[model samples]
Target: MKVAVLALQGAFIEHEQVLQRLGVETVEIRQLKDWQQPIDALILPGGESTVQMRLLKELGLYEPIREAILIGMPVLGTCAGMILLSEGRLGTMDIEVRRNAYGRQLGSFHTVDTVKGIGTDVPMTFIRAPYIERVLSDKVEVLSTVDGHIVAARQGNQLATAFHPELDDGTRLHELFLGMVVGRSDKE
Candidate 1:
């Protein structure tokens, strides 16, 4: 399946590398035009939400992305990307983010914790991650958490994670996303 990684900024290249390792065709998304191409899934890598939001506005992708999510396009957001997927954020996020919820970047580290639906003690890497303070709807399901803070969630075909799954060499999350893509296609 073909997956597109938002390359506006952040660790998008790392996501692309992980996808490539899984033997999936990957594309770097630099413009709204990149979204014109058919893709089975998309990834929004960790980065500064303020900058990413501005870039989205500059590229006219904010609404398109929202619309795509509504239509059931599978999306995976990490760190700052996770902040974007939430219904609301804690502090004055560029586009409404929680901001330094997991402390500073230097405080980033890896952990093996049990998630709600995914599995137990999964290795998760956090770098200045944002914690999910609240879920807006039943359509969203919490997938993982650390110390009772929600770290991963899935709203229909959309998935968001506070940690960098790509950096961990664990393909389970990617595989889960691929499953979502495949399941959606089968239903259609």
Candidate 2:
């Protein structure tokens, strides 16, 4: 299946590489025009949320993305990407976001544990990750957690993670996203 990784900034290339390793066709999304292409799924890589948001607005993709999620286009977001998908943020910014809740990049570490729906203990990398303070709706399903805070969640066709799964050798999360894309395509 074809998957588009938002390439505006951040570790998008890493996500593309991982997806390519999984035998999936991948593309770097730069313009809103790119989203018109027939792709089974999309991935929003970790980055600065404020900058990403501005880029999305400049590219006129903010609404398109929201619309796609409403229409059931499977999307997987990581780190800053997760913050973008959240209905609310916890940082000091105008939007409620717990900025650097996981501490700074230097504080980044590895952990092995079973994510709720991803299965088994997966090695997750967190760099200034944001935790889910409150899920806006029942549509969002919790997938994983580090402590009591929600780390991963799926809202219908949308899936988001506070950690970077691409940094590890494991492909469980990628595989799950692929499954979601395939499942959605089959229904079409």
Candidate 3:
């Protein structure tokens, strides 16, 4: 029931707040030691992808996190997080993500859309977001799209979204991630 939120950068606190409101225990992961805790799942929040990756490596957390996800540790990645998990970075989620696909900060906006398994009119807030340019694996399921661009997807225990679900009041996305976490625990 405990989730680790990557606090090295970005909207991590927002994710933690949402998870907390859902009554889930959350731990901020800011260092390699934090990753040692008994977390049932992990959240990679939105931020600058390049900086996040640099910190992950410098802090000696990159490989462990990636390997953990590959081995089925449930993870929810948002914005830059989606980029982090894409083909070239963590390389766990088989998707190619284009960073800041929505141009600059001025391009950020909000809208309501349907996320595949989450019902209709899901509020989505995009801030310097990225989009899945192409899915490299058949196992990856496209969850939602905005203006024909892939915005949300799930691959096994890994869930990724270009928009910040934490920024909105909706719990479907976070709840969906919790479902993945519970599903993982059940299998064990």
Question: lDDT of all the models against the reference?
Answer: 0.79, 0.79, 0.95
Q: Pick the candidate with the highest TM-score.
A: 3
Query: Backbone collision count in every prediction?
Result: 1, 8, 0
Off by over 4 Å in 2: 88-97
Candidate 2, which ten residues in sequence have the lowest lDDT sum? 88-97
- What is the C-alpha lDDT profile of model 2 across 1-188, one tens digit per residue? 88999889898988988888889999888998998888778888998988888898899878877677667788888889888876543211112236578788876778887776677788888888888877666656778878887877776677788889888888888888888899899999
RMSD of 3: 0.6
Say which prediction, candidate 2 or candidate 3, comes out ahead on TM-score. Answer: 3
Q: What are the RMSD figures for all models against the true structure?
A: 3.2, 3.3, 0.6
Q: What is the lDDT for 73 in model 2?
A: 80
TM-score of every model versus the real structure: 0.91, 0.91, 0.99
- What is the Cα-based TM-score of model 3? 0.99
Residues 41-118, model 3: lDDT tens digits: 999999999999999999999999998999999999999999999998999999999999999999999999999889
Rank by lDDT, descending? 3, 2, 1
TM-score of 1: 0.91
lDDT by residue (tens digit), candidate 1, 1-188: 89988899999988888888889999888888888988888888898988888888889888887777667788888888887666542211212236678689787888988765567767899998888877766666778767888888877777788898888867788888888988998988
